[model samples]
Target chain A: MWDTIIINPFINLLLWIYMMVGNFGVAIILFTTLTRVILYPLTAKQIKGAQAMQELQKNKRYLDIQEKYKGDKEKLAQEQMKLYQELKINPLSSCLPTLLQFPIIIGLYQALIQSIASAPLDLLKLTRHLYPDFLKIPDLIPLNTQFLWMELGQPERLYIPGISFGIPILTIIVVITTYISSKVIAPPPQPGANDQGAMMTKMMNIYMPILMGWLSYTLSAGLALYFVVSNVIQILQYAITGKIYWGNVFPWLKKTEIKKP
Target chain B: MKNKILTIFIVISVLAISLTSCSDMNSTATSWGGATVTDSAVYFADGMQVIALRLDNGAEIWAYPEKAAANRTFLAAPVLVGEQLIIADAGNLLTSINSRDGVTQNWQFAGAKGKYIDSPLVVGETIVAQNADNSIYALDLKGTKLWAFTAEHSFWAQPASDGQLVFAPNFDHYLYAVNLETGVLRWKTELKASLVARPTLVDGVIYVGNLNGDFFAVDSERGTILWETKVAGGVWAAPIFVDGLLYFGDQTGIVNILDAADGSVVDSINVESGIVGSGVIVTDGIVFGKENGDIITIGFDGSNLGTKTVGGSIYSNLSINGNLFVVVATKGDNPLVAFDTDVKQSWVYTTSKK
Candidate 1:
């Protein structure tokens, strides 16, 4: 079922794009851009949802109700839901798109491994998954997986004489990009009754980089490349939508104020 | 409560990512060894055992790993020398089995430090075996070490011989021509990049391709690159010489017909997917395997014969035995498959997990 819906279609699309580009690295970049494009509307909706939350905070009725039921946490939650219903706002609307993207991400991860098959066994498995439409390309088989210095099929590691044994170069890129994107996507919390949410977000920001770094270090450079590209694109998309406030990110790096100012 | 749920979700995703990445690196998918087709049966390596099945029907004749003690998977293809079938795994272990009954003849372990990554070359009295490390060992028929040679990088390409000299292509971007008798280096030629394909010798010229997509026609006597041409992709499989014409495919699925006398392109054909170590077989005409599980057959004059799509990807080492062309699918519905000369399906055999 996974193959019929996601894996097969994803693999077929990846190879089809690769056939057009003639380079695996370029193919990955194109496919990632295409995915980002498809999910753009959902991303816009998420940003709009955030904007609506800020608008609701500014409303006098919402603030009065919050103060009126401040002592009773349960009543405060019930009133907030009532207000949300009046405004025709669904809090979970933003999350629906994100939930839908999980399968696509998993499918892309699987496709990256199969598409850049270095081993004969890997190639065999890939053939079984190829769609008939992909087979129509004349020079489609044996897709060249070499991109720049690294083989897209193999893990990207650089060997230095006196530095380290084998340093995963792409893995490092993935980690750095993940960190940067997290800062942009989920900035520091505003002063509100959301201390719990703030702490959880902070913990997640720290945990994700480490986890991504380990996975990137192990998987093929092709998938690592996908993560890096996708993260950069997500950050850019947030920035373009004006949802990301640059000042909120990396507050420690900000310049100290002068007395005259 | 929502925050706690989000925390759990994030934790699960992080754990899943770590687990999936680890699974990708250490893929438990059973890698299949290249097949050898005999008159009656087709033999191939699956997991730790080598199984032989009847060519006409998909009946299992015997398997080496039927016993618990003999259960060890191999990365290298099994080479049949005389009555002994030599199979080497990724580890430094070589198990010899009798071809007739699948009995364990001999097991040689700890002789080399690295695992065998390619086919064991049988050059005269010595069976030359190259490992994943930058080392090569020459063993006698009894699996005794005769001599060993080391290069600068890992030896990925299997060593080929012109009877007197053994040509070994190394990932260090050099091709060494060593004397087979003494295991002494006679000459070496540096190429555009590291070579991953087997070098073919016909008439005094050696034709080989490097990872950089450069195909070279080297003079066998002097070990000099006479002329170099370009292919579409990396040549992971060995090229076959048929009727003064060289037939080979690259990783990009481009199969080229090169002139044997001089390095010139005759014709080029592309398959549906990358050709991972698959080459052309001159049975009936030219039969080649593709990573997309398509067996593309082309006539001698570069005419399109026909293509047969199997349930699995076909390896480069497609073996021809009598009226049957046998190839194993590393992953798919059919683990072991045979096709007739007319490109018709003969039989398909599936394997049981260990």
Candidate 2:
């Protein structure tokens, strides 16, 4: 079911784009752009939901409930649920769209790997996923694996003259872009936000970049390119919405206010 | 609220990590181990290490590197050139080891930028190797590169030669005929699809098949298509010629016996499983290993002689030395199994034991 619905379609679409562009790297960029564009509405909804939740944190009644029910943990939960209903807020709204996008992300990664098959067995498996009605496998095959200096199928490295070792340039770029994207798009903590929330945000801010960097460092350069492109697109989306918190990435810059949708 | 958010992030991180790890595991070289057989022993390259075993009882003689190197993976069959056994790894390094002890450090060829999938073709003093880097490299016995012929796509199948010209089947949908001495393209005949099977040079004609199920017999000297015919499914194995008949299998698990003169199907037999490896001509009949772990023997008249189940998938080509037939399988307790012309199992070698 996953192969028919997600992987096959994605692999065919990627191959079709490669046919049109004549370059695998450009095809990947175009595919990532198309995916982001298609999910724009969901991204907007997620941002709006998060903004509303952030605003609810500053509500006087919500703060009073926290303080009033500080001693009674079970009462606190009941009061929070009642307050959520009174305000017409769905706590899961912000997470739902993100949860929905996860499959697409995973599918796209798998499709890229299948499309840039490096070994004979992987290539044979790739043939099973190709839609013959939509693709001319013979003409588009060997999919221009070379993109600039990287092989796209292998881990990216930059070899310089006199340098004995190849540098993990793409991995470094992935780490920086991931860090910048998370920091710039994250909403600044409200003045009275709980310390726990702040701590969680801080943990995510650190963990995400490291995780992305490690993945980029180990996996093929094609996926590292995807991660870099996805991070950049995310930051650009936040910038267009005027939701960027540049102050988080660069302390000298003033933070932007979360725009009401 | 904070706990839920943390939990969600943690879940996403763990899921992403798990998915990434899954891909990483799958992305490692997926080709099966290739084996080469001689009179006394069999040399097998099983991804992690290359081992030479006695042909009689499947006892290990020696393994290269002593301990398997994590960075190196060997999938191509070891090519025996005099006293040295030449093996190429997925790490883009080709090493020539002493065939006797498998310990001596031989000259290594690190010229290609891509992994070596097919074994190098030894034509006298010249070693003609096709690489995944879209180049066919010719090296001397000492591992020094002579000349390279670059193509539009990679070469997965080993190149064949008729003394003067080398016939290389490429994924670029072309059968390249290059001058063996200068590494220059004499002529290239374009096929219907990507050619993954090695071309069989019989008499003066080259018989090869493509992944698009189109098989062709091309003139070796002129690169002109002599005849073309469609098979039941994609042909991943090379056609073997015996007397006046050509035998080959397809991905649909059907074996087609074609007349070598006109490319007409004389008979077809369905084995119910895909055949990726090329078959060998035994004294009794031609033997082929299927993807379903069945070692089948078919007579020259397209009759099923016998079948023996190995219980593991066989993707590598079957190797034969005298009366002994060896096959390497995946996902079983024993990966290397040897049999005879009677389709009876002789011995099984477990790779994990070493």
Candidate 3:
């Protein structure tokens, strides 16, 4: 079911885009951009839902309920639910969209791997997934894996003269972009909110980039390219929404308090 | 609070990684290693070692390296040159070992940047090897680089030569003819689809098939398509020519027998399973192993001589030495099985690992 619904369509669409552009890297960027565009509304809703929940933390009634039912755990939960309903906030709204996007990310990764088809068996398996009605397999196949100095099928490395080892240039880019995207999309540290949630988020902000970098360093350059492009697009999306907290990424540039008499 | 969101993100990331790991995304073994035979031994690359089995009883003769390394993989069929066996690994290293004991390291070639998918062709004093890096390296007897012919795509099929020009089939849907000595492009004939199987060069003509179900007979002197015909399915194995007839199988399990003079289907037999490896011509008939673990023998008149189930999908071409016909399966208790002329099971060689 996953192959039929997600992987097959994604592979065919990627091939179609590759056919039109004649470049695999460009096709990846375009396909990712198109996916983000299609999911724009859900992303917007998710952002709004998260912001609303954040705002609810500062609400007077919400805080009163927390204090009033501090002694009674069950009562506190019921009051919180009532308060959420009154404010027309759904806690799951933000998470549902994120969960929905997970399949796309996984599907795209699988599709990219299939489309590359570096090995003989990989190419043979790819032939079974191709939709002849949608595109011509003969013309699109042996997809131009070469993009700049990197072969999209292999891990990217930049070889320089006299250098003993090739540098992981794409991995570095992926790490930086992932770090920046995580910080940019993160809701700014709520004043005096030293909760476990905030602590976990901070930890994730560090570990996620390292994990992404490690994956990029090990996996195919095409997937690393996808990660880099996805991160950049995410950052751009948050920036466009006027919700990006650049101060989270650049602490030195954060505005200092201007005390006046 | 926001902790739920963080927790969900963490869970999702872990799930994605777990799912990706479960998929075939990181698989390096593309296909089963083909088997090469001599008088007393049958040599093949199995996972981390090149194994030699006794031809008569399928007993272990010797294995190279002696110890298996987790980082190394040998998948291409080992080509025997004199007393040495040339083995290509997935690590882009080609090494030649003494065939007698599989201990002495003859020479190693580490110039290619891609994995060696097919066995290198030994033409006189030159070793012409096809690499997934889109180049064919021509090395000398001492493992010295001589010349290389770069193509647009990776080569899955081994190159055929007429002692002068090397005819290489590429995944770019072209059959390139390169000079055996200088590695110069003689001519490249564009087929309808990607060519995965080796082309059959007989007399002065090249017979090849493509993934588009189109078979062609191209003039070797000048790269021109003489005749083309559609088959039942996409052809993944090279066509075998015996006498004046050419026999081959397709992805749809149809074994086609055609006239070599012109591209005409003389007779065809449906074995009900896909065939990825070319068959060998036996005295009784032609023998083929299907993807469904069936070993089939068909006559020149398209009659089924005999059939036996080997219990694993056979991907490597059937290797025959004397009356022993060897078949390598993708998975089974007995991965390597041999048969006689009557399609009777001779011996089975079990792989070390599952």
Candidate 4:
């Protein structure tokens, strides 16, 4: 009874929102904002870890210690742990916020699929009874899944007749903002700039957008909209705290210098 | 970092605006087409507009645009009453337009707000229709309401009439029978799943399919289940009665022939695509138009009759006029077509209304 009355209806309400909004992209963004605001403390701890990682890079003596212990793998691990402890930094802090988003992602995905007209009946049974027939479009198609030039059920196709609506201009903005945020907030590379970590970051920087674009192409347009919107919102939140980078990389961004207390 | 935040803010502003703006601009495409065939011409509900075509040459006679923007699809094949074409829009209103010029005769019936979803069931001098909220209404030929009855759930399928009783399937998993004239509840039979297909009345039995993939024959007088046979897929398509046999297609693309007398599966054949609308037009020795977005004409011996790849799901039921079979396909580049038993195309046209 509770499943049908409570849990079922709540899930359906979210689906109703997706149907009404017509884009899963916007749905994800709104969901991210609400979650981030709720999990702000955890995100703040992550930022602190990032700040400490940056400060640790500035320690020349610490660099020497790492180099001296580098050859002895076990000893290097101990030394790194010691160094992290001394700096009051936790490595897990850096990944906690990202990991937290997983559950929300699954929930949002379930909600998006449920609201569609073609979704199976069992899955749709999870939907709430808030709007009994909210997504029931007349005649031709049963679900109102159209957004922009793209079908909300399919990936973003960039073509705007004379202009390119490709990759969802909004989604592109999200990726760019996410890239900029990483560059601004992420700690600078240490003396060993060609290290494995640096290589991984470079790979990530190139691969993530490509992956998002590919996903945008195959998956629902609603999801792409969500990614773009959430990235943009986080960027704004970071900017409020002066954590955003306004460096030469993005010459257009307004620059602000950090002054020590 | 600042640049990242700046970029993020800029992106969000754009996405938010675009998302909102895109939704405003994202009007639903009316891909569904239903035609009301008359002696002079055929009236079609194309998207939000009503288009009239000459029955002889399939030429455009007239078009009524923006008649009902409620997204109440014209799925219940158009009903022609004298010179008026009746179609339901989004359950809130039922419109009767002049069959000749596409002029509005009556737009909204008073207190008919449950949102009419099914096509009006024309019985004698009265026409009956069901709404999404399970309200059964009986209206006169001129769109005047005589009586109405509400059931336990929403109504997505068209109502079935057997002269005396109106069998309306409700989303609440019930097959309800109300008197045609008085709109009084006669009897109700609860099922395990929601009934989305319109029932076909044969003899004294109401044969209907449910969401749980079970097709049953219910006694019209007692509202008791006589026999139930499960199909592989949910029956979204209404059952079609040809002669003494019941023919219908399930969502799994299987065409089944039921006994109609005992609710026994007589013959079942699998097709390439899931059956969209109910199977119709059994000609000479062939059965056709179940699924695969194609006009499949199959021999009674279960051999391939003739197939035409019309890329789209069959959303509209087959309408037969003499030797011509009309089937409206959904989600296709070309949505409507008329063909003879030989599989030769009589006329084909595309409407962007949906």
Using TM-score as the measure, the top candidate is 2
**Model 4: residue B84 alpha-carbon error in angstroms:** 1.2
* Model 2 spans > 4 angstroms off: A71-75, A160-167, A255-261, B1-29
TM-score of each: 0.63, 0.93, 0.91, 0.61
Residue B81 error, candidate 4, Å: 0.7
State residue B177's C-alpha deviation in candidate 1, in Å. Answer: 1.5
Give the distance in Å from residue A226's predicted Cα in candidate 1 to where it truly belongs. 13
Interface RMSD of each: 6.7, 3.2, 3.9, 11.6
Ranking by lDDT: 2, 3, 1, 4
True contacts kept of each: 0.11, 0.46, 0.34, 0.00
> What lDDT tens digits, residue by residue, belong to model 3 across residues B1-354?
566666757785795575457343334445676788778689977756788998888888888878877667787788888887899887789898899999999899999988788788899999999998889999998899999889888887888899999999998999999999999999998897888888899999899999878999988889899889889777887899998889999888899999989888898788999888899878789999898888898997889998888876887777887887888887656778888777778888887532
TM-score, ranked from best to worst: 2, 3, 1, 4
Q: Which residue pairs show collisions in model 2?
A: none
Task: Write down the RMSD of candidate 1 (Cα, Å).
Answer: 8.3
- Per-residue lDDT value at B234 in model 4: 64
Give candidate 3 misplaced runs (Cα > 4 Å): A64-88, A192-194, A256-261, B1-29, B305-307, B331-333, B352-354
How good is model 4 by TM-score?
Answer: 0.61
In terms of lDDT, the poorest run of 10 residues in model 4 chain B is B22-31
Residue B223 in model 1: shift from native, Å? 0.4
Pairwise TM-score winner, candidates 3 and 4: 3
lDDT of each: 0.73, 0.86, 0.83, 0.63
